[model samples]
Every structure is written in C-alpha cells, then in structure tokens.
Target chain A: MGELYRLRRKIEQIIKDGNLDEHQTKGKITLECGLLLALINENTPDEVNALRKLKTAAEKLLGNF
Target chain B: MKMNSLKLKLISLVMACMLANALIIAWLLLDSFQREKNTLAWQALQGAQETYVHLEENCTRTLSATLAALLADEKIAALYQQRDRDKLYRYTAPLFEILKNDFQVTHWYFLEPETAAPAIAQKCFLRVHNAALYGDVVNRVTYKNAVQTKTFSSGKELGKTAFALRVVHPYYHQGTLIGYMELGQEIDEFLSTMQKMTGDAFALIIDKRYLDQTEWKNVRNRKNLPQNWDDMKDAVLINDVLPNKEITRFEGEIEKIPAAGQILEEKQLGKSLYMKGILPVYDAAQRKVGGILILHDITKINSNMKRTLLYSAVSIFVLTLVLGGLIVFVLNRLVFKRLDQMNQTAIRVVGGDYNTKIVPTADDELGQFETLFEQFRNVFVNAVSGIENAESKTIKTKRPVKKRKPRRKP
Candidate 1:
C-alpha cells in the first residue's frame, strides 16, 4: 500500500523471479538503502529520502535504475 | 583506493619489494666498503712492518760497513789491543758523534775477545759514547756469537731501556784475534723515519717482563718523558712517533701480538679516525719481547666511505621512488584503469544500458578477457530480447476472445 512497501514487494518479486536467496537479496538492499526492509510495513510513512533510497537500492540490486 | 583492491595490493607488493631490494643492496654495499677499508688498513700495517724491517736492514748494513772500515784502520785495532781507553775514546768519540748525527748511529763499542779467563772474556774494553762506563761484561747474543764464530755478526738486541741494531766484527791484528769492534743504532730512529716515510704514527711497546721498572722510570725521567712505568699492566711505551702521547696508551699484551702482525679495530682519536695494528718485535734471539703499534690515519677514507654510502642510499631512494612511480603508472595504464573501465561498463549493462560495450585498450590478456565479456554481453542481450519478443507474442495470442473482438472491430 505504501510506496516503500511497493518498492519492497517489487524487489521481492525480482528476487523470486531470478531464483535468488530472499534473505540475501533483502540484506543487500537493506545495506544499500541503510534501512531494514522487515521493519517497513504497509502503514509506514513514505518519506522522500526513504522513497528515494528504496528506489535507488532496488535499481542497484535488480539493475533497473 | 579500496583496501582490498588488486591495484593497491600490487602497489604495496611493489613498494615492499623495492624497499627490500634497496636494503639488501645497501647492506651489500656497506659490507663491501667495510671489507675494502679493512683490507687497506691491513695492507698499511703490513707495509709499515715491512718498512721497519727494511730500515733495520739498511741500518745494520751501514753499521756493518762502517765497522768494517773502522776495523781496517790498523791504529784503532792497535789501540784496542793495547787496552788504551783514553786514546780510543779520543779517536772514536768524534766519529761516534758524526755517526750519531749523520747516520743515526747511537752506540759504539770495543770489546775484549774470548780469553782463557772467563772473568775477562767479552769485557767491554771501551764504549765510545760513554767513557765513564767500561769493563762491564758484554753478555749479549751478538757479542757471544761474534766471539764464538770469529766472524761478522749483526742483529737486533734489547738493552736495559732501548732496542738497537748492533753489528759486531771480530777484530784481528796480524792474523791474531785481538778484540771486537761493534757499531750500533737505536731502533727508535726507525720509528721516526718510518713515520716520515708513511705519515703514520708508531709506538714501541716493550713488555714489562723484559724491562726493569726502576730503569724504565729512570730513563723516562732522564729523557723528561712522563713516568708511565705503572701506566700499563704488562708493557711500557718505550717510544712513539705520535702527535698525541695519549695515543700510545694501549691495553694489550705486547707478547701476544702475532708473528705476522695483528690488525686492531678502527678507533676515533679526537676528531680523526685511525686504524691501529701491531707487529710483533723480536730480539736477536728471536724472542717476542715487544710490539710495534702502528696507527694509520683513516679519517679521510672513512668520511669518503660514509659519503659514498650516503650517496648510495640517496640514489637508491630516488631510484626506488622513480621506479615505483613508473611501475605504478604503467600498471594503472595497463591493468587498473582498464579494469575500472570494464567494471563501469559491466555496471552500466546491468542497469539496462546493453548498447554500452567493453572496449579494450590493448591486445593483451585483459583485452582478450574484455572481448570474451563483450561476446557474453551480446549473447545475454540477444537472449533477453528474444524472451521479451516471445512474451509479447504469447500475450497477443492468449487474448482469445479479445482477439476475435478486435477482428470484428477491424
């Protein structure tokens, strides 16, 4: 529902499609975004920096930036 | 630079190797220089010893020739045979003075030959230098040898406070043995002459065992020299041709010097550096009685060596820096920069820029790797494009009723 949750779901889908490890892919994105994906729920506020960080992390991990 | 990057590791390895090589070269150079300096000091010691021997030989030869000429004078032989002390002294004192002044001859002697009475045999008939001292039994090896062999004998002899090169010839009158004529020179003159010849300092250290301390003290006092009889443990400094008397203070056994000589360590005396050595001094009986300490000034040579080492170190540092810079530059050009280019291109391709290619700068191994990577990128891009096209076509086919509606609309 939230923009952060949408970005997280898109990353999860890319990882599943690529048959990549879920925890490792999330960990890499978390490291890149400097935020924990497990804590980012649908009700979480979509801050501008958080959204930009999530988009950049997803683009870096999945190569669609 | 990244800590674990290949470029950093390669650069670190190169620097370490260069440092190690420079250290090894410096050590080798220093060792070689030290060995060469030591060899030069050893040669100087040997040369000084040889010069001493040569001077002794020349002094002995001159004394022998002079003694022979004096023995040829029938009057001198006749005066010794007559036991005329006053006339002999008057005749030879001026000659002794000339010999002392011109030839550095210090002692002159006339001795009674071996007779049936042992009390009178080898008695000092006359000492040309000292008319007050006479009738003392001459018990020296050279005198005994000349009396026994009845021929010319010459050798180095140690006296109460001095060493001298003595030459003895059996005096004969009308083919009958009369007495002995001897000419002598003090060996201290050799040290001074050798110093002049080689510009090196020298000291004669006689063993205390061969010397009486009272007589040594008395001689030192008589000569107005320092009464240093108790200065050394087993040896006394008899004479030295040194600018500083302190340089003659050695703390080693004179008799322990090797026959060929012993090279001592370099020492810094005042502002100058010196290389010291010792040549064993043997009396006529071939007994090691003393040692000749030789000191050669090596300050200039030592400074030169240090300067050379400093230059070498600076040169190595500069060369290492230059070489390191060149190697780093070449490696960055040939490998690091190109690898970085390949990494950026790979990252761009992963980010959907498939048209971006890896262009190799050289036809080396990295270039070959770049070509293979480009081929793999081409294959991957074509496969992805084909999959995308297939998926679109499948989506169009799967429209079914929508496709029929689309055909009705058309």
Candidate 2:
C-alpha cells in the first residue's frame, strides 16, 4: 500500500523470479537500504527520503530502478 | 585471481628479491673467476721469469768452470801470448766442440787486450765458433766491462742477430793482462727449455730499436725461417714455441711492461683458451730491450667456471620456485582461505540466517573477529524479533470490532 512496501515487493518478486538465494538477497537489500524488508507494511509512512532509499537499494540489488 | 591480489603481490616481491640476489651472486662469481684467471696468468709469468734466470745462472756457472779449466792449459796461454791465431784455433777447436756437446756451450771467443795503439786496434783475436769472422773489434758490453774492470764479467747480451748469455774473464798471463776469454750460449734455447719445463707457450720479442732489421732478416732467412720483422710494429719476434704465431701479437709498448711482469688479455684459439702475459727482458747493459710473451692454457678452468655458474643459476632458480610455491601454499592455508570463509559467513548473516553462528576456528586474529561478529549477529536477531513483536501487538490493538452494527439492528 505504501511506496516503500511497493518497492520492497518488487525486489522480492525479482529475487523469486531470478531464483536467487532468498535470505542472502533480502539481507543484501536490507544492508544497502538500512531498513528491514520483512517489516515494511501498509502503515509505513511513504517519506520522500525512505522512498528514494528503497528505490535506489532495489535498483542496486535487483535491477528494478 | 587478480594481479593486484595480496598473494600475487607478495610472491612478486619475493621473486624480485630472489632474482636480485641471484644476479648479485652471479656477478660475484664472475668477478672471482676473472681474478683467478688473472692470478694464474701472473703466476705463469713469474714462473717463466724465474726459470729463465735459473737457466742463465746455471749456464754462467758451467761456462765459467769450463773457461777456468781451459785456462789451466799452458799451450792455450802460450799460443795466445805469441799472437798465433791458427795455433790457438787448432788448439781450442776440439775443446770447443767438446764443450758444446757436453755443456751446451755455443760461442767461444779469444780477444786481445784493449790498447791505445791504432796498429793493433783489432781486439777480436779468435772466435772458435766462427773461425772466418775474426780480426774485428770486440765492442760488446761484457767485453768492455771485463776490460774496464780487469775482472770477471758475465751477463746476457744482445748481439746483431741473437741473444747470448756470455761470461767473460779477463785473461792474465804471468802478471800481465793478455786479453779476454769469453764463453756464451744462445738464449733461444732458454725459451724452448722454459716451454718444456712449464708446459706453456713462450715468445721472445726484441724491440726494433735495439735490433738491426736487416740482420734479423738475414738470420731468419739463413735459418730457413719466415722473416718476422714486419709481423709486428716496433718489435720483432725472435723465437717462439707457440703452436700459432698469432698468439704472440702485441701492440703495446714493450718498454712499458713492468720489470716483474704484466698480465695480458686472455685469448681464445679455436677450442682452447689462453692467458697471455709479458715479462721484460733486460740485456747486459740493463736496458729493457724486449719482452717474453707467455701463454698459459686455461680452457679447462674456464669451462669449469662456466659450468659452476650454470649450476648456481639453476640451483637458485629451482630454490626460488620451491620457496615461492611454499609461500603461496602457506598464505592460502593460513590467511586467504580463512578470510574467504569469513566473507561467506558475513553474507549469509546479512541474508537473515542468524541461526548459522560464526564459530571461530582458532584463537588468532581472524578468530577474534569471528567471535565479535557472532555476538553482533545475536544482538541483531534479538532486536529484529523485538520489532516484529511490537508490530504484531500494534496490529492486534488496531483491529475493528466485527458485526457490532448488525447486532444492534436485531
């Protein structure tokens, strides 16, 4: 529902489609974005900085920029 | 692996050090070998000079004793006092032949005393070796020294065409000086004898300044030998025992050669290597008139040195290879491989596999890092779990009551 959650979902789908190691891929994205992907939900505020960080991390980790 | 890797860099540094050391060792070995060659050449020169002196001394003693024995003959003194050249020759010719055959004596001379009178200026009374070449003035240094001192004189003197070790004794009969009796042997035989004694080649070079080119050419021609006056500049090769005459070629000033000797450049003749040198040859007047070129064979030693250097190079190369391999193996086993393991463990922990603990394999530095990372992973897992629980409780509290409006309508 939130922009950050949407970016997180896109990263998850890319990892699944690529059949990459799930924990390793998510952990890489978490370290790069400095946020936990599993905790991202609809209640999360779609702050401009958070959204930008999520998009950049997803782009770097999953090529989903 | 990348070239910039630590392992490759360390190996490159080690290899560079080893290469530098090998080059230094090779340079030292070559320098030592060169010094050894020069020393051998110098020793050969010294040995040749000593042999020449010893032979000359022996010849002087033998000729002195023979002349002493000849002077005991009353008839020899009587014939010389009467100035009878034919009787003196007839008397001493047989004795001269015996002396030549027995003691290697080659020249026998009888001379008249120096006089200021012009009518008797011919000082050469009789030459037993050359009966036809008489009535000539004896102007040799040995003759002059003997006449001037009125005593025994002996030294090596260079003649018009040859070098002879002559021993001249002032002849005195009944308290009056009669003349000089001299005995000599050609010094050409000294070169051959020295060659035989030392198993090295020798060449006698007389400077053109001290020699008559025409006389040298004539003697060479008479001996059926090649005229060698043009073979060299400023000097002529009088005699040589070298298999190849080209080895005697020298271009430097003969007078500049040191008195003790000088080592020359090494020469390669076909399959053989030779160390050449020069020893100054002095005449009775103590003039440095020539040099004796000495060539010593050093092929075996040179080949041995090269073989030793090859062996050393191969040994160093093999040692470097073995050492490099061992270093790489130890580095990989102790550092790179363990660091790679730590890298993989960190990636898995970042992927949320917190249960997989980073167990330290040793008590070393890497092990200490692993223990610290494991403790951090535990804290991160606990913190994430606490966040998840807080989020679940907030969701439950925010849930809306179900069907409350429907119950009110009923």
Interface root-mean-square deviation, each candidate: 11.4, 2.0
Model 1 misplaced stretches (Cα beyond 4 Å): A1-65, B392-410
- Evaluated at residue B114, the lDDT of candidate 2 is 77
| Each prediction's whole-model lDDT (CA) | 0.84, 0.84
DockQ for all models: 0.07, 0.55
lDDT of 2 by residue, B8-110 (tens): 7887887788789878988998899999888888888889989989988888888888888776678899998888889889988998888888878899998
**What value does the lDDT take at residue B389 in candidate 2?**
79
lDDT of 1 by residue, B248-359 (tens): 7778777678888988878788889998888999988889998888899999988999999999999999999999999999999999888888766655454345677887
Docking class of 1: incorrect
> What clash pairs does model 2 have?
A23-B351
